[model samples]
Target: MLLSAAARRRTPCPGGALLVVGDSPRVVVVGGGPGGYEAALVASQLGASVTVVERDGVGGSAVLTDVVPSKTLIATAEVMTLVDGSVELGVRFPGGAGAPTDPGLDRPGGAVTVDLGRVNERVRQLAAAQSGDVRERLRGEGVRVLSGTGRLAAPDRVVVDPADASADGPADGPADGSAGEELAADVVLVATGSYPRTLPDAEPDGERILTWKQLYRLQELPERLVVVGSGVTGAEFASAYDALGSDVVLVSSRDRVLPGEDVDAAEVIEDVFRRRGMTVLSRSRAQEVKRVGDGVVVALADGRTVEGSHCLLAVGSIPSTAGIGLEEAGVQLSESGHVEVDRVSRTSVRGVYAAGDCTGVLPLASVAAMQGRTAMRHALGDAVQPLKLRTVAANVFTAPEIATVGWSQAQIESGEAQGEVVKLPLVGNARAKMQGIHDGFVKLFCRTGSGTVIGGVVVAPRASELIFPVALAVEHRLTVDQVAQAYSVYPSLSGSLTEAARRLHKAPSVAG
Candidate 1:
């Protein structure tokens, strides 16, 4: 229900007279992910006393396990893949055995083994260090770091359960009990992020069968890895592990890999995966995963079983939005269990807001940060506008890294956007040839009549970074001729973007 001007005027701030008379209100944020931490900082800057309650470390799963660690591991994998290609580049080792083995690169079957023990240790260390930095920064900004889980006892009150071990006199346990501290606040920010989703039948054992979280725990690489799900997460791990020397089989329920991404970009990666000896299983649904002797068996819906030494399920993630008083607070949730919030992140319940993956907005850190900031602006009586999805840029971190921003060809063809698509292959680029990279393209979609760029796709090494200019063009309604005029380096891969735009300007028309 939308509030009327009279209702808004009568809504009382938690601080009562002090808040009404222009005193800063106390704002409590639960969860320390990007959304939570960013909101805490913003609220404190706006002169609100802020407290962040976190069960896990401050950076949440994004920094602690998912994005940072996975990207770092990908970096290592990239280096190894490049080194493996050295033989073709005339970089030879004596006796054809490659260079003298670095103990770090040595793994079973003469492949580069990621020392997961060292990797996990390093990942945790980095996450912890980053978390500490966030905590200190929040403290500097006058936001209290409350280390515990937070529960909303009332619409205007939150209760924090402190670490259990602190009161138990340090026995085998950390601490035992406390009544818990209650905090009264004007506005509550719920940014508790998500976790890896698992199935009851294919539950992870943290050993042979695992989720993305348990990947860093291993000391040795698997002999063979079978990845279930063909979405972004599944594709990323499959690509990374294949590069890391695991004989990988990626099972996809869709006709192609990365169903959510640009169809052409997904096809390119799928083709590359096939060429690299990673088995691609399309339209295969894994019904269950059971542990067999020394290996895991994946039962498909078709009565066929695929056995591998290890199985990693990457179906998707469920929002972390239960048992935190959302229902009691009357916050509306979607049918899929996502918190239903406006573009500015206000929940159905007054004085409550949500951001990040919980709201089921685009699951990007950038989106989370934007939603959090917008929520605070709306709640604090600042001039606010609802979010515009048109400007969002997203990237899939894969071997070639698929990045996209505005209009999509499929959408245009389906009459969603009456646009023309111009695709430019990387083989025509001088730089791609010089770099020994030949597989990728730059694709641009624009309103045929107006010549304004509406969407674009970049499929190349560092495509994530290169797609931004195109994204900006789409967001700002820049024309193909305008983009073509911009100075791209003489011999760079990014030149393909401008060239693609130039080509789109030359195109007469598209069916749409």
Candidate 2:
């Protein structure tokens, strides 16, 4: 059993002679993603000799392929979107700004064009720089970094194989006389992360058909792009490509795009998507994608077909936990192959823990980092608190970004929570009005009894930045009145959050 924080401080380090007052435990972390590296750093700070084994470069997919690269692409798309509305804001350029009055050399060849090659090169450079930063930070903190695939040999030992070797090979074998190095550890953390899920019938050819990661490699944008799946990834890419001047068709297997997100936010975004001339095919499940003559065709479940210059599959992700010797060391995994971990990141096996997408927790990088810290604190016998995901802030990086934190409306409607909800449209916000932004809103949920702010959803330009205070309120359990009392700059989108909280606090409480 884990000791309480107070008890842990009083307890002496096991098998220690007080060399420097406490024992420095050895910690070995597998997969140098946000979760693994963050835990290594924290464990090192707590007097642990740490080692991180990574097959891929440091920062994992979050920096190298998924999060950072996608966001960079989104940033470019966002600029284009803003430029599209510049005319409405009274901004003028050569050729009379806004839409071109004439298509043929309108006002001496004045038009905006997205250079896919330059944008992709910049995205790759940024991702590489961030990965290098993570690598440098880890090494500077006295953590040993190994470029290899790591697997458990025993409860207290990890065997690392060369990156080129098959990870499924014998764990303890010195068969080829180059079986790789082994490291003994007092504790181990698994943060192998995940990979994009691809369908057998719809394989990405890295050209006309691509995954989210491969989209950045194109030299020229697709003339007409067909995006499969309308989840967060699909919606983001569809919105981005449309903004970047591509004829985008979004195929959803559900009733609407972003079906899993807040209904109102999804509706608003869908409206925006249609208004921007995107072809949204609801209840359309893509069965397969096949290459045609210089294009691709996406066959739907209902025997319909959509052809485009390119096809992108954004179904979901699968955890990278297979053939890593996890179960061999007695670690439990969910039926879906994700590590089964508790709130403190502990697995069923003693002295072993997991974090990030591999653990099937919230798939956000921020949540992964928090889980890593929690794992290290618990492992190093320091004061630690289990993670409460209710306060985690998540954002969908579409045109008008959607950000949400804390208790959702589903929780309230299901009778699991009782809260008063107040929604303030972004149209009412002075900054949004001035910017010619007419879509999106700020919705806040407050506990009915105590008026404590529970959750919130923000849908506006850069909603990711505006959702921070609501996250703070949820994390600190601040009351609606307390949140409302805070000062916000005039003519700002964030002021809407304060306004929503004020309204919630003023409303009568509803009993559960």
Candidate 3:
């Protein structure tokens, strides 16, 4: 709801009391994840007194467990992949086993190895430092940082429980709860993130059976890791572990891996997975997973069985909304338990906004941050733009990464989007050839008549970095001629994007 300056409600300033005129808005942000903290910063910048309440940590699961830790571990695995290819790159370990890392260069069964303990230690430290940085930054911005679970007492009132001994967030209060503090708010933001989706039959033991969150606790890599679910999360871990010398078997309920991603890109990744010795079990579903003695066993719905030293569950995530006072406060929740928020991030209840996974929007940190800023802008009566999922770029960090933006090929095929598609294999790129990379492609989608860039996909070693230009074109509605006119570095993978655009210089009569 946009309001004029004269009609906007008075909010809290630096002073204690919240009810008054000609002051900042009292913004209480619940959950200190990307959505919460980013909203807090925006609220502060918009002349609002902000407070962040979190029980996990300032960075929430995105930092503490899920995104940061998994990506950091993947980084180590990526380094291992690079080192394993050192010999092909004209570099070799001198005298074989003389190097440090306890026979790192020459493992009995592998060419390169990673120390899971040391790698996880680094992951933990980096995540903690990142969380600390957020706390310090928020405090510097004069935003009150409360380490506790926040509950909505009313639409305009938030009560914070002083963190107990079990919480792992920054300490802004005593460990033991002596009492609770309540704050009046002109606007409230709920950014409580989601947790790993689990099933009754497939429980994580944090040892042999584990969720993605429990992967970093391992001191030794799984000799045979069976990963259930072939979605983005499963594919990523399967690719990472395969690169890091694990015998990986990926189980997919769908006929192909990455069923949600680009079909061509999924094919490339699946082929690469097979070529790299990782088993791909398509059209297979695991009914239950259980620990049997030292190893874990996964029973298939088809009466088949898969045994592995460890199992990683990467099915999906559930919103962390239960028993959080949202329903009690009259904030309407979806059947899936996600908060129902409009594009502007406003919940059903006025003065209450939701962002991040809780809102059931695109589950990306970048999307969360954007939703957060947009929510604050709307709440504070500032000029704002609603969240645009079309302009958002998404990347799957596999060996040959897959990055995509805007309208997809499937959308175009289904007539949901009108566009012309041009696909150029990265195997033909000069840089890919020079780097000994043989897989991946660059596919571009543009409006048929005007040649306005609509969408694109990149599959390469670092496709994440390469998708930005395409995303920029799609977001700003740049023409193919404009993108082609722009110079990409010669002998580069990015050149393929422009090359694909150059091929689409004129609207095609049909798909080519």
Candidate 4:
């Protein structure tokens, strides 16, 4: 689904030497993921003829198997959670509690059943449709789409293998008859994303033992699910499956779930998971995984074993920077195989840029998009700015999402940041009480000397939405007192934002 177009808006040339009418600089983008397509569009807009070559759909992993699909499934699971309390809310179940009146104490069939086949089908359909829409949008923008695998043969040379083109065909043959066909580009942007990392002893069978990417192939909910790794993806799947009625076991190598997240947020989720019957095995490392009869067994490094109907490995992701001509082009790779780049996404080799997961920045779609645009600007000698992690906002998509922007509580507590801290619990919120909600809080950190908002965390349903205010405050350099004075709804969950800010304003003066 990678597409590129001729320039809709052209850049003026200084001497007209490189701006010849028939020889405009041709740029080829490899990968249809966020980084590739985004840059393709921008490069086209900057007067370069652009072409995007991709092996899969336009939206890449974020759209196809990860973000869009997982979020859609989460939305469905949320509705099921809401509907399960119909009786408690005084609403009749599909079959009234005692409609027959025969056996007053009779056990009813399942209150609701999820058609996994239909649900998965819908997930795939929506994902594919969205990918197609992106392709169409690129086409409308005049970008050409090439369905193929692309590789760099040299700094200014590329080879594309059309998905259906024969290996022996002239178009499929590289200029030197190398493995890949050879094409030329004035500049190359490597945006190939990544795949879910699999353990050496535990391989994904797309069934019993699976990676996060392969879980989309499942048509039936697992009776018992065991998730390995307590990272962002692992925690998200564990929380989501628990809400969807799976007996889940989360294995963590650290002392707590989401060890890298804010401690308070991690504790809140850990407590909720235990309360909800999710077996969280902290300080446990999965040494190996194997199939035992109809179930799977995860052998822990501590000699403990967990058996479950399905096992999901979310240890991490490995960049797809291999098998390309990255090394051949003098582009440096990190020790972990990531493309080594500076803040501007430039590789060691000039005219070569890498972005997104390949660059080892936070693997968020938003960050990937930003990196891509910045790379295009820099590559084309336009305006360029380095990536700023200080204002980046990342959200872990658990039940009560944990969203953090700027500095973390641990940073302040460890004296890494000179900031005052304030926290407001949701238990006292009138709207939260009305909605029968609890177990959430708003926390803020402000610079002690200047009172300028520095960082914050929000733990709540729709925390992703609520974190925007904190992100804005940090970006605009708003002071805690100014934030406290901002108007918030009288009886809304968002009121906690103002409350936290007010507390920050009351903190005693401190020195950096």
Q: Please give, for residues 45-116, the per-residue lDDT of candidate 3 as tens digits.
A: 978889888887788888888788778888887777666545444555745333334222232235445777
How well does each candidate superpose onto the true structure, as a TM-score?
Answer: 0.89, 0.90, 0.91, 0.88
Those runs of model 3 whose alpha carbons end farther than 4 Å from true positions after fitting are 1-20, 94-109, 162-179, 507-512
lDDT of 2 at 12: 37
Give every collision pair in model 1.
164-175, 165-174, 165-175, 407-454, 407-455
Q: What tens-digit string does per-residue lDDT give for candidate 4 at 1-512? A: 22133632344433211232445567778887888889988888877777777766677777788788888888776665555433444445665453323221121234666776687778888887878777777777777767677878888777876554321101211111223556667668889888889889998887899887777778889999999999999999898887777889999999999988999999999987787678999899999999988899999999999999999999999998888788988989989899987887778876778888988888998888888888877777677778888999999988788999998878988999999888888889998777656578989999988999999999988899999999999999999899989999989888999988887776666999
Candidate ranking under TM-score, highest first, comes to 3, 2, 1, 4
Residue pairs in collision within model 3:
none
The most accurate candidate by TM-score is 3
For lDDT, candidate 1 versus 4, the one ahead is 4
C-alpha RMSD of each candidate structure in angstroms: 5.9, 6.1, 5.5, 6.5
- Candidate 4 versus the native: TM-score? 0.88
lDDT for model 1 = 0.79
lDDT for residue 297 in candidate 1, whole number 0-100: 97
Model 2: per-residue Cα lDDT over 1-512, one tens digit each: 32233332233332221112244677899988899889989988988888988876678778778898899999999988887777666566776545444221122223677999999889888887888888888888988888788899986788988775322111111211133788877789999999889888998888898888788788898999999999999999999998888999999999999988999999999988997789999999999999998999999999999999999999999999998899999999899999998888989887888999998889999989999998988877777788998989999999899999999988888889998888888878889888878889999998988999899999998999999999999999999899889999997888898888777766656999
Determine the C-alpha RMSD for candidate 4 after optimal superposition of all C-alphas. Answer: 6.5
Report the lDDT of model 2 for residue 371. 94
Best of the two (2, 4) by TM-score? 2
